[model samples]
Target: MIDDAENKEALTSFLQKLVNDSYEAELRRYSSLLATSSRLLTCDSIILVALSSIASLIVDGRVSISREAFIACVCVAALIGASILFSIICQWRIGYKDLASPGEQVKFVEKSWEKLSSDWNIAKSYSKTLDIMYKSVSSRNNKISVLLRISVALLGAALAILLILSLCMINRACAGA
Candidate 1:
């Protein structure tokens, strides 16, 4: 037979723990999205460097290639660079999601404290917080997803263009042009 005040206090403590854990878990889920973006950025950088290095070698007279091949190399480098730029933008956006900000954290704590310490329900507060955070993450991730898609598409297009142009150059080489 617990008194009513003690029961209320115990419920508040339990709810506080549950809400905090839920919030932390939500933040943890975002880590996976960031990791995926990071891996994509790495791929973009590696391919850009490898392609540009080969292009530079040929373009600088270390190896002779036709003007068409030269053009292809230049185009490939530019396109890959563009892809990298977009990826960088995606990373920048990821860098500043609302939950990452100190001010937002403060606001969240204040709201949680107010709700959990008063007549307000912790579960309701957590529900609303989750919904708001989800919308924020979803909208930002949507844009980042779009940017990643564009980056991938551009890289593919650049590779295709280079392949087509390189094949033409190879034909010319075989014909002793």
Candidate 2:
């Protein structure tokens, strides 16, 4: 009887250790995901600020272009910037909002580990899907930011060229008269 009890206890200990180790690994992965999500949010904020600045310049008549084209560009940039901001907000709500309290996630993971010992595979699969979704959203955000930056550069260049040409035309008119 003594040997049987000892063997059972050893088995239980081994199982517990396995659960603990898996939970720790998962917790570490979640921490990394949180960090990456935060970084993406910050980058989106910076892009929005830049787009807003460009829109301001256009609204304030600094670009020296026809009202129609200026308004159109400003609208498009504003829409893209707003969409990016919205995406970041949604991702934060879905991925990181509950993780704000320190160590809460770790405790949750431990509890989950205890309850779902036999279902670790399912949990791991779900986690992988969530990670893929995060990456997809992050990639979309980066692409939109790049497009916005290119649009800003092209618009600025066009405005500058228009300004130079207008100045030349005015100079010619004055000289001819």
Candidate 3:
């Protein structure tokens, strides 16, 4: 009976430790997601600024921009920027929700481990669920990041084209006068 008691105590301790580790892992995953979301927001801002500058150049006659092309570019940039902003907001909320209270979770897990039979299988299952949640969040973040990068690239290319066109128009006007 004494040996059995010792074995149960050891198993309980091990299960508690596993829970603590899993909670920490979850917290780390949440933090990473937050960081990624912030990066995506910043990238979106940069794209917006570039697009605005392009618009200003065209308005001021610095770049000879075709009216239709300029309008189309603005519309496309706006759509992309808005969508990225929305995604970033959603990611932030998910990260916030997943953030674990280290002290509280540890205490809860310890209590549960003490009361429950030393079942490693239960702890393993919980850890697996946590892993799945982390992966899903990470995948969503990656998709948004990719979209932001593509939008930034498109905005940059459009700006360059506008600048060149504006310069050409100025040259033609000067020659004509």
Candidate 4:
């Protein structure tokens, strides 16, 4: 009976640690995704600025941008804007939802530790907590991952369009000369 009790205790400890570590890892991954999204937005902004500058030069007659090139630029600009918007929405959707305040979490953990000495009730409670945390984080991660990928693809398409537009503008300038 004593050996069985010891084994159960060890198992509970291991399980708790495993779940907590996994939760932390998920949080880290989420943070990294946010960083990536931020970088994407920054790049999008730079592209917009360049497009605006070119449009201004065309308006001022300093550059002869073809109608096709202008249309392509507009399309690419729209895509970039859409990508940024979708990315922000995705980040907002996966934003952190606090299950418990820090103080409450600490108190609850302390109580669970106290219960550990008396019975397996604390282990059971921890199991439930871990389940909830794991599922929530995993769901958010999956959703954000899909959205991020789409956003990236949109950005890539925009860049390609911008490249084509630049080529068209160059050809127009050469022909005009």
| The candidate that achieves the highest lDDT relative to the unseen native structure | 4
lDDT of each: 0.72, 0.53, 0.62, 0.79
Per-residue error for 169 in candidate 4, Å, reads: 4.8
Count of clashes in candidate 3? 2
Query: Which residue pairs come into collision in candidate 3?
Result: 63-166, 64-166
Global CA lDDT computed for model 4: 0.79
Error of 2 at 116 (Å): 17
Tens-place lDDT digits, model 3, residues 1-177: 325767766775786677667657655755675675566567667767777887799789887756756766666576656656554554644332353578976776777775434455455555665666566666655655565556446545655655665577688789989
Instruction: Give all candidate RMSDs, comma-separated.
Output: 5.9, 10.7, 6.9, 3.7
TM-score of each predicted structure versus truth = 0.65, 0.40, 0.51, 0.79
Candidate 1 vs candidate 4, lDDT winner: 4
Local accuracy of candidate 2 as per-residue lDDT tens digits, 1-177: 224756656655665565456545555554555455455556556655765786688679786555655655555456545545544543442332222244865666576675545333334433553455445545544554454445445444544544665576587779989
> Where does model 1 exceed 4 Å of error?
1-29, 93-120
Candidate 1 lDDT by residue in tens digits, 1-177: 335877876876776676666656655655665676678778878877888688678768798876766777778888888888887887784532344477876777786685575533655565566666666676676777788788889888887997798788778779985
Ranking of models by TM-score? 4, 1, 3, 2
Worst lDDT run of 10 residues, candidate 3, spans 90-99
lDDT of 4 by residue, 106-173 (tens): 88878767665644566567667767877787789888888888888999999898777667767877
- Report how far off residue 169 is in candidate 3 (Å): 14
**Candidate 1 residue pairs that clash:** none
lDDT of residue 29 for candidate 3: 58
